[model samples]
Target: MRTVAIIGRPNVGKSTLFNRLVGQKLALVDDRPGVTRDRREGEAELGHLSFRIIDTAGLEEAEPGSLSDRMRRQTEAAIDEADLVLFLVDARAGILPADETFAELVRRSGKPVVLLANKAEGRGGMAGAYDAFSLGLGDPVPLSAEHGEGMGDLLEAIEPFLETGEDEDDEDRAGKPLRVAIVGRPNAGKSTLVNRMIGAERLLTGPEAGITRDTISVDWRWRDHPIRLFDTAGLRKRARVEDKLEKLSVADALRAIRFAEVVVVLLDATIPFEKQDLSIVDLIESEGRAIVIGLNKWDLVADRPGLLKELRADAERLLPQVRGAPVVPLSGLAGEGIDRLMGSVVQAAEVWSRRVPTAKLNDWLAAALSAHPPPAVSGRRIKIRYMTQVKARPPHFALFGNQLDALPRAYTRYLVNGLRETFELPGVPIRLSLRSGKNPFEGKKKTWD
Candidate 1:
């Protein structure tokens, strides 16, 4: 796919535009300027054109020795890599010196530049739109990225530049399934375990730690489900990491976590309840991905019965975010319990991908609310009227109710726990959002009346 870079000064709605084009929140947006420090790439489609859109850091001429200089370098690198550049300027602020400087930089690159005068919604942007032509890039495309206005003109400008014809192997590319990352701390047997599961010498196996440097994603199939398995470098504490490659490897693992649908966090059986392990679990949960825990090198541990009880307790105590998650014990080197591990993965993934019907979900909600009524606030009883599964990769629900503003966190947990138990959803993160208001149809007269 052709690469299109969105370049602009800070707070110019570049990310907002990027997200609108990509149809996903791949980049974080906030009122704060320069929230984007890294170059984010996502697949975007405009009419019949599909391309990779890169959201780059805002370009600023910083002093020779400064962080902004580093940011400038990153932006320049993105500009170098892009096939087309969308030079964004704030229409509300008019043409600033930074805009002029960046316009020159874009010109120097000798690439096709589309000057976008963003925030051109009101009369305030009229003068800026007129002033933008002086930059000599081209007639500015007046756009309000936040409101999604003037997209037709933007598409019209780029349509001519788009390379014609589709690839012959488009079906194969479209059919590629999700890539999963399996990661954990040292001696977690991540590599050995992966080798065992693939039934090959896919990765090096040893008693030593930190054998994997680069994050290696191996493409394979399980139960006819196509998967690219990423075996990442074992993450050590930041203080203990001294090598540059290890730092890069750690970043690569994090990138993998961001991209993957399912992340298997392998744990060492000997010291499974470490703070670092908990941190990894928190990261996966925060990323809103499906997770499964594997207690590896289990053959080395003694007191199997007692250990199982303790492990369950630890999982409950430390990782309540993913309650009722499946924890399987396996020795990667010996190929023990490998089938159960794969089965758990498939089961967890199915649950993660599950979408509860609106009727069935409301039914579940009614029973749950009846069992444990919501707490009253200021003598007014809160009533949950309806519930709907808004979206799911790991299922997310939106609850509409009366006086739900006063709904207690404990009650929310109760509903979530009930939903998990009732639906048999295990080892996947679930989200519940509460919205309070009167039912729109409540005041309406019946047709018979």
Candidate 2:
């Protein structure tokens, strides 16, 4: 896909424009400057045009070897990789010394630039928009990103730069790779595990905590099956996440989870099942992705026999949402048990995509309701009429019944557990959607009982 990068000084509504183009809020937006530190990429569409878009950090001049400098390097890297650059400026704030500085920087890169004067909804910003011609990039495309004003003009400006061609055929798309994401707390050997899996040192790894600040995806094949593995930044507790850069990294990792089909929650075996670890598992279940618990750093705990059994018990007890998940003990550094881990991953993906027939699902629901009837509410029994599988990729079901909104939490758990056990659907989260029909005899002067 043709790539375009959004670049400019801090807080020029770059992320807001990015979210608008992608038709979703994939990037975090804040009023403060420098809210986005690392670059994030998403597939974007404008009218009939389709291409990949990148949201980069705010360009800044900082001291050598500082965090700000690192962010600058990421932006420069994006500029080098992009086919076109959308240089944005705050029309309301007017052109400043920083804007002039980055304009020179983007000019020296020799790439095609589309000058954008953002936040120009009224006549107040037109004076600054007219003054932008002094930068020598071109005429500015004035538009308000917040309210989406003047998009037709903006589209007319960039249409010539986009590549035009037919898309790939169905046979080519049938071979698409499976997406798997590795996520956990800081310094839990996620990058190391990725390196071992791909048999190459592609990612930067060290003993320090939080060495990775971006969610990197690597494409490879495993035993003839193509796979795309996502190595994400370590997620920390919200109370302790005080750094703005770390917050961006966490948001990137969460986007990775929502993109993947199966998620591997790698826990440090020495201190397995901490509060943070459980929290991570809960997040995965909430996302409704297939779960695989990886007990990394197992070599250090090899002397203690029967610890794996105890941890298995702990997993079943602590995380009932993902009970019966595959827990594999392996050392990412030593590369032990990788084959078993891959096998479990493939199996989990199959279960996650499995579909049950409507007849079979209705039969199971009948047996379950007969064996243990639903509890009464306000001296009336709730009726569950029928059930059917709505979709797959972590099985989702729809239940049609009367007064379904008043169903108790315990009864919902009972149904979910029964679905998991009876259908042989393990480790993947099941979604039960209650759909109730309105009563017809309401306010009828006691016409029916």
Candidate 3:
């Protein structure tokens, strides 16, 4: 598929156009300049044409090795990879020196450029749109990305460059990439593990614990299988997270976990099973995300045998919620056991997406009921009429029965464990919802009051 990159100086609505093209707010947009420091991408469609669109950071002139300079380099990389460039400018702000500088750079690249005069909703921006001809890119396509106007002309401008053949990305058509979120408490080497897994320094890592602030996603292929990985900020205790920015970062990380198909909780080998680490696992289980535990920094362990045994015991005793989750020892730094970790991820994903046939489910339900029937509530036998899977992906089941709300938590755990064992589900959270069945004799009159 062809790629289009949105580029311009700060606060020119570059991200707005990118989001409009993608039909979703994949990029974070704020009135503040430089809210977007990293490039994000999404597949977009325009009329009968489709392409992969990139949202790059606002261009800025900075000295080499500076943060601003780093952002510029990322934008340049995006431009280099793009088949076309959507150069956006705020029509209301008119032309600036910075815009001219970046326009020169875009012209130098010699890629097909569509100069977009965004914020041209009214006559307020008409003069700037007219002045855009001075940039020497082309006739500016006066557009209002915020109000969703002038899309037809914009589409016509770029449609000529698109290849008319069908999209050749087979992986996208066959199935969606597995969405995995690598999460843990601060400094568990989550970013490093991602870098090692992709065999590239795609993420910025340092000795700092909370370097990653946003939930950044990247497309990667592992063993020819496409994987979309979200690298998130390290979560600290809520009380310890005092800064407002850190709070927002934590919130973003939680969103990633909620949307992820599988979550790998990276644990520091020396401090495996810390209170925070346990809490992170508990959160993943509660969210019903398929989970795998990667004990990172295995190279640092002095007594591997003793520590591994202790860790296994702790997982059994403490993480009963996900009883049989895979706990693979690995060193994210040394890349040891990374392959095993990926295998565990694949296995967990299969279990997470498992769907049980209704016939087999009822059969297992009967056997489970016969083995250990639900105890009576208030001396009345709680009759469970039937059970059926409601959905998969950390499978959810709905059990119809009498007085289900009064059923003991222990009984629910029994059914969950039975379902897990009988269905061969491991390392994935199971949800069993109790729903009261309607009484058949409800409409009948009560003769004796």
Candidate 4:
């Protein structure tokens, strides 16, 4: 894959431009200068070109004998690994001494450089663009990174250097087996449950809680589907956390949650509803991933009938975001309910990956609106005209309507629930977005008329 590095002095909108190019906030951005101390990488596409873009720490003069030297070394190492460099400068601040020094350093590397004069939103930055000419990096591409201006010029500048072979390989890998993470509080029997499903003593069993420190991923075949299962450390509340190693373990689990396509949150049967468990569910919902609940150690619960009723009620009350999600009961030690647990995992994953055809999606929307019209508000009746599925890692629906700004949360939830039930999409998160716009053909006569 072709590599491009965004190199610049601090507070010059490098991270913002990085986010814009990558189409995601994979790198952290802040107003404070030099907030990014480490190099971050993300895959980016411009028109038909695709490349790996790296965002590096700001280029600055390091104190000869301080921690700043370490940062400078890291930044230099990242720059050395790039095929092209985007040297960004703050046009509002004009060309400074640091910019001149970095320009020489980048020129010496002999890589293709695209000098960007960022913050060029208005007349205030014209003089700074002129001043940037002294850096000898050719004409600057005047841009406003925050406002998403000058993207065309920036893309044109680097179009000749992009390589395209990697895109074919990426498309080939898109349908490969998914990675799943199983996590919850300590003593939730996550390891035991995973071992039961795999039919081996693959993970260590223990009576003590918090036995797993590092997140362990195991690759196995279920029926004919290839699966990678991750057993993560039990997450504890922030205030209760003490040791640094445990804190790091929690962070690792969180990272696994982000990396995995599906997350199975194991809950102790006896104490199934806790604040931490709810928080875990909320995290998965916020991350827009599919989730299934495993009520493990069910063999230990004495009141089986009453416990089942309570569990159902609690799940509905706590996780309304993912309504109708599957909650399977299993005893990992006894190898009971393993089939149901695996079945639920596969079902939820299938739903997570499912895509709806645009024609069928709009057809369903038309029928649904006819059956139950949106409520009237402020003497104006809400008219939902059409709908489309924009993007679907988990199905996200976009609705074009009149007066959609007044669409109530309850009505949105109602549509989401209807979609889940009608489409057989259980245990996966579904998003519904409403946008208001005027019809372009509102006053025109139809040909059929």
Candidate 5:
């Protein structure tokens, strides 16, 4: 994999871009500059290419031998070691003298550079993007790292620099083991369910809350397909977690959810849909992982008539974000409903990875828009010109149109629901990104197809 270092001045959204590419919040981010003091690295994927991405501390001139100076040295070392450099500049802030100085440093390294004009989501940053030509590092790629815009353009820009030929490992990705994480609240029988799944005492289980204080993984085969199971410590309310170790464990559980392709949210059948349970499901949805709600300890529940149907209805009403997710009733200790749960998991994974053809997507978009035309905003009708699935580990789509920033949230939800139903993408989080017209000053009118 090619190594690409993100080199820029302070607060240019390098860490945000890094986290976006890595598909995990591995780096800490804040409004304040200089939040990062060391070089952080992670594997990143863009379209079909995968590479190693390095997030370096903000490049700032400081006193010799000072902390800031050492950080700068580390960044310079990263630039020297990287096969290419992603030079980011705050498009909203425009080009700064510091940016000029840093460009010279990266230019002197003689490495391939992709100038990123970050924060160029709307028209506000376009002027700066045009001014970036003065930096003499080729044309700037307008990007919005926080909103995940311009990623398609970035992928095209860097594809030639990175290796794209598939290797033996890449060939195995289709047959690779599916990763599934079991997460829930404390005393929710997470460990019990994990032990029952693998049919072995691989994890410590008990009635005590917080018995498992770490995220543990187990490898097993189910019905001939390889599977990796991640059993995470039960997550409790943030207010209830005061211990430092518990905090670390919770963070680890969160990371496991982000890494997993499918997440089985194990809920106690006796007390289902607690605030923490809903919050955990929300986290899984936000992370764009396929979801399966496991109603554990079902054998202990007294009510058995129509309770499963009621619970499924409640899941739809309470968690519409992951609407139609499979809800399995099982007793982990008794090993009941394990097959059904695994079946749901495998199906959810397939749906999460599903992709729709652009022709079909646009056909659906036209019908949906015609059925319920977008409401006029400020007396002008919002025209949705095009729609296409950009990538699908969670089925993210891009919608191009005029006045898209003014598109109402309710309307977007309607379109998301339509896509879900029309394409049969149930239970998986569907990402719909809106891309508005370019800066009007470019002497070109926005065209619709």
Candidate 6:
């Protein structure tokens, strides 16, 4: 991965800027100087640009054996490893002696740099931003990372230093790894499952609840496909999450789920489908994510004939929103049935990202309308004119028709269900929206041929 390092002196809002760029608060931020002591790295994006970003400790002049000296060493190490450096300055503070010193150091390294004048949001910092010209590190990208101003200029400045008009990972690769998050209530074997899949005890796991206070990610190849897996903290009722740290952890987990292409709602097979579990699944579906249900701790189950079948039925009856979502039973500790769980995950992702061609979609719609024509309202039947998929990654469609405002909800459900069955889009939510364009000859042409 191409590396972009954010470098500056202490308390110049480097950590805050890093969090803003990454779109997540992965690094701790404080008003105090030297709050960040270690090098933190995350995937970052600036408009169309995506790269690995490193956040380094602040640079300072310190005694040879002092902690400040060690922090300076870490900053130097980050600069050495960086392909591009974002030399950040506090525009409100103007050009200081330390800014000039760091500018000289960056100049000596001969690395490409995008000078950022942070905290230059309003007229307050304009003069200092102009003063940055004396540092001789190229024209500064004057902006505030806090309020996110001047990002367009920043992206323009950094574009020339990036990987030539392509994302770092998307240059001619056949398929991108499926980003999946496995989330559940606390003590649902989330960490244990991650440890088993990686074939190592990388994550701390035990019988204790709430051991994982953050969302941790790992990459692995499974069944000839790349999988980027995120193991998240178990979510509980918001009323129960009084602790500040747990609240942060929960927020972090929610961010993971939003970024994920697919999500596995891991459930304790022993106590499956608690109220919280259903709510979590509701949240995933509401986010328009592909979902798979894993029945963890299956080894302890005293299996009865038709028990698994009945359980799947319950999933349908309970989760009518994601009515046909896959529910796979597995033991994360024993590594049993993992292949099945992965298979379901892959299948769900495929379905989630599946797009039907416009021609095929119209054909399916015609057939569906023929099979079940719209019911008459009073004396007139609603006219359905055109149907096409406007987006994928959850498969949203727009239907241009007349009298849609008066159409019943049951009829809309019929169309949605018909699309699901006709396209074989099982385990994926189908969105069908009704639109009216006021075509002059609306009912004359009932279908798109």
Best-matching candidate per lDDT:
5
lDDT of each: 0.82, 0.88, 0.86, 0.82, 0.89, 0.84
Model 1 worst lDDT window (10 residues): 165-174
Clashing pairs in 5: none
lDDT of 6 by residue, 4-72 (tens): 999999889899889988999999998899999999999998644698999988888889979999889
Residue-level lDDT of model 1, residues 1-449, one tens digit each, is 79999999999999999998997788989988898988999999864469999998888878976888888888899999998999999988888998888899999999999888899776456435656878999877777888766664576578656654355365555445555789999768899888887889989868788888888878878777777888989888879988898899897787677557788899989888799999899988866678888898888885566887789888988899998787888888899987787778877878887988999988888888787888888998998899987556668777888887688888888888888888877778887767666567887987973
lDDT (10s digit) by residue, model 4, range 1-449: 88999999988999999998898888788999988888889999763468999988888888875667787788788788988999999999988999999999999989889889999776567445656778999767777778766564566568656744445566534544567899999889989888887888888879998899888888877777678899999998889999999998997788677657789999998788799999999888866678989898888984566777778778988888887788888898898987787788888878887888888878888878888889999998998888776556567777777888788888887788888888887778886756577578899988973
Candidate 3: deviation at residue 401, Å?
2.0
Model 5 lDDT per residue over 187-281, tens place: 99999988988989999988799999889989888997789999999899889999999999998888678668899999999999999999999
Q: What C-alpha lDDT does candidate 4 achieve relative to the native structure?
A: 0.82
Worst 10 residues of 5 by lDDT: 164-173
Clashing pairs in 6: none
Q: For candidate 5, give the lDDT of residue 253.
A: 88
lDDT of 2 by residue, 170-216 (tens): 65456557789999999999999999999999999999999999999
Task: Report the Cα lDDT for candidate 6.
Answer: 0.84
Of 1 and 2, the candidate ranking higher by lDDT: 2
Error of 5 at 150 (Å): 15
Please tell me which model should have the higher lDDT, number 4 or number 5. 5
Counting clashing residue pairs in each candidate, in order, gives: 0, 0, 0, 0, 0, 0
